[model samples]
Target: MRPHRCWRPAAGGWLGRRLLRPPGALPEPFFLGLCLRCGQCAQACPRSAIRIARWEHGLSTGTPYIAARETACDLCGGQAPACAAVCPTQALHLEPGEPVRMGTAVIDATRCLAHMGDICRSCFNACPLRGRAIVLEGALRPVVDPALCTGCGLCEEHCLVEPAAIHVEPLNP
Candidate 1:
């Protein structure tokens, strides 16, 4: 007989607003199915960006995720993304040369320093993809390009505001 699967709660409630999956992770359904829930991806993360969900997160418990506001994905710098590389089940599969899509960064102009008439280019300057993923508009306002952004959360990580002016909206969230 097959062993019983330990099912956690789904990504709902508070988790839905905060969960950010590791770079190159498969879509929600596919990832949940293929992931071994063995904590390998979290262990392989060099920046310690990946974390397993807790029991409070329900069905997503033990699932790997990221909280970009706290720490962001660095793309592993000069190597294949570690989380994907270590996922034995390919739940975090990454196609060669394809850009990862963690989510899209949304700017809250009401809270952004630049949009509020200050000279803050922190978000644009911090972007790994720079001019491509995030660009400077007139008056140094930062704009996120959905087509080019991987939603790696560098912008959110670098934002100086008490609450980040720019934050990623996870695909499943």
Candidate 2:
């Protein structure tokens, strides 16, 4: 008897374990255990901020999720959110404030096309959270509600064109 190259079992335990994995590149917990590795988050993103976690986090590799290096959560509105809507799993949970229960969305008015008066609202429209999270300030400026904004970087990832109008930053305790 012999085993075929294509037909082989996993090298290690498939269940119960801490699974010491690699450090997440994305500022947010995009690679949280709850993630199903589906690229929907990336595909739906207008700004293309969402990307797959290509590196090996413990034993899993190619799992669909964003790495800290590639992007982070914008924490949309603090109420409604975009990524959460697309995410099949509750992996990308909800929270309030700049920490976004997970992360925070920061406004880089200088880089933001909306602030530049170029006309872009990918973030505004895509945001699942609202009211306190992200506020539509003036014509194009979007004010982040620190008390209600989660750091879920969705806004940053959905900005039209190049440099995202908004960016995600780890919530400062």
lDDT leader: 1
lDDT on C-alpha atoms for all candidate structures: 0.83, 0.51
What's the TM-score of every candidate structure? Answer: 0.89, 0.45
Instruction: List, in order, the clash count of every candidate structure.
Output: 5, 28
Span of ten consecutive residues with least summed lDDT in model 1: 6-15
* Model 2 error, position 46 (Å): 18
- Give the per-residue lDDT of model 1 (tens digit) for 1-173: 64224432455324245468888878887877888899999999999988888766666778898888898988897478988988899988888987788899999999999989899999998899998889888748999889888888889999999799999988754
Please provide, for model 2 over 85-167, each residue's C-alpha lDDT reduced to its tens digit, 9 standing for 90 to 100: 57666555444332335445677888877788776667777666654577678756677876665555567666765666566
Error of 2 at 102 (Å): 1.0
Clashing pairs in 1: 8-58, 8-59, 9-58, 9-59, 10-59
Clashes of 1: 5
**Cα-lDDT of candidate 2:** 0.51
Off by over 4 Å in 2: 1-100
